[model samples]
Target: DVKVTQSSRYLVKRTGEKVFLECVQDMDHENMFWYRQDPGLGLRLIYFSYDVKMKEKGDIPEGYSVSREKKERFSLILESASTNQTSMYLCASSLYGFNQPQHFGDGTRLSIL
Candidate 1:
């Protein structure tokens, strides 16, 4: 079974602070993704990586960045967090193919004060 774990389930941060959200997958999937969930916007992809050190920008990548130095680990970086950036962030991993089922972490609810 694949297990995706986020570093924190809930986090609090102040505006302008740099934040790092970590995710790890035990299944050794080749593709990992970062997304944010909001009420009206639904789930928007922030970034994705297909291999170590290779990243691609997703739908919403303006204020976010990603790092995947290792196959099993992916990190989401918020350069300068703002109140509008507060949301439920999710981490997911899948096999290297189309239509693959992705395993997702529980999510981290981030609040920016």
Candidate 2:
């Protein structure tokens, strides 16, 4: 089974602090994604990496950046945490395209004060 692990299950940050969320997958999948899930907004993509050192901006990428130096790992960096950025961040992995359903980690609920 494809497994994705998130660095934190919950996080609390100040309004302007920089935050990093890490994700690791054991499936050796070529595609990984970072998304923020909100109550009524569903899952909105933040960033995605198809290969090592390559990344694509998703629907919402403002104030956020990503790194993929290794195939099995991806990281989401929030340059400055804000109250609006306080949401459930989810990390997912897939074989490649939209055909395969993404396997998601437990998710990290971040709260900005």
Candidate 3:
């Protein structure tokens, strides 16, 4: 079965700290995505990579970055995190378009204090 695994289910951090959230897929998918979910705004795409060593910015990529050094793993980095950056981070993997459904990890709830 396909599975997406996240390194942490809960995280707490201080302001100005650097945060790293990791995700891995076991199905050898070609695409990986990072999204932040908030109360009323819904899921907002932060970043996504179509292939290893390649990535593209999504709706809100201003304070976030991503790395896909391996086919099965992806990492989301928050450079100099802040309180307002706290949210539920989700990682997903899927085959390219044609209405492919993405498999998602449980999510990392990061709280920047």
Q: What TM-score would each prediction reach against the true structure? A: 0.98, 0.97, 0.98
Expressed as tens digits, the lDDT of each residue in 1-108 for candidate 3 is: 799999999999999998999999999999999999999999999999999999999999998889999999999999999999999999999998858999999999
Per-residue CA lDDT of model 1 for 19-96, tens digit only, reads 999999999899999999999988899999999999999999998989999999999999999999999999999999
Those runs of model 2 whose alpha carbons end farther than 4 Å from true positions after fitting are none
**Structure candidate 1, residue pairs in collision:** none
lDDT of each structure?
A: 0.97, 0.96, 0.96
Best by TM-score: 1
lDDT of 2: 0.96
For candidate 1, the per-residue lDDT at 15 reads 100
Which 10 successive residues of model 2 have the least lDDT summed? 93-102
Clash list (residue pairs), candidate 2: none
Candidate 1's TM-score reads: 0.98
Q: Please say which candidate is ahead in lDDT: 1 or 2.
A: 1
**Model 2 quality (TM-score):** 0.97
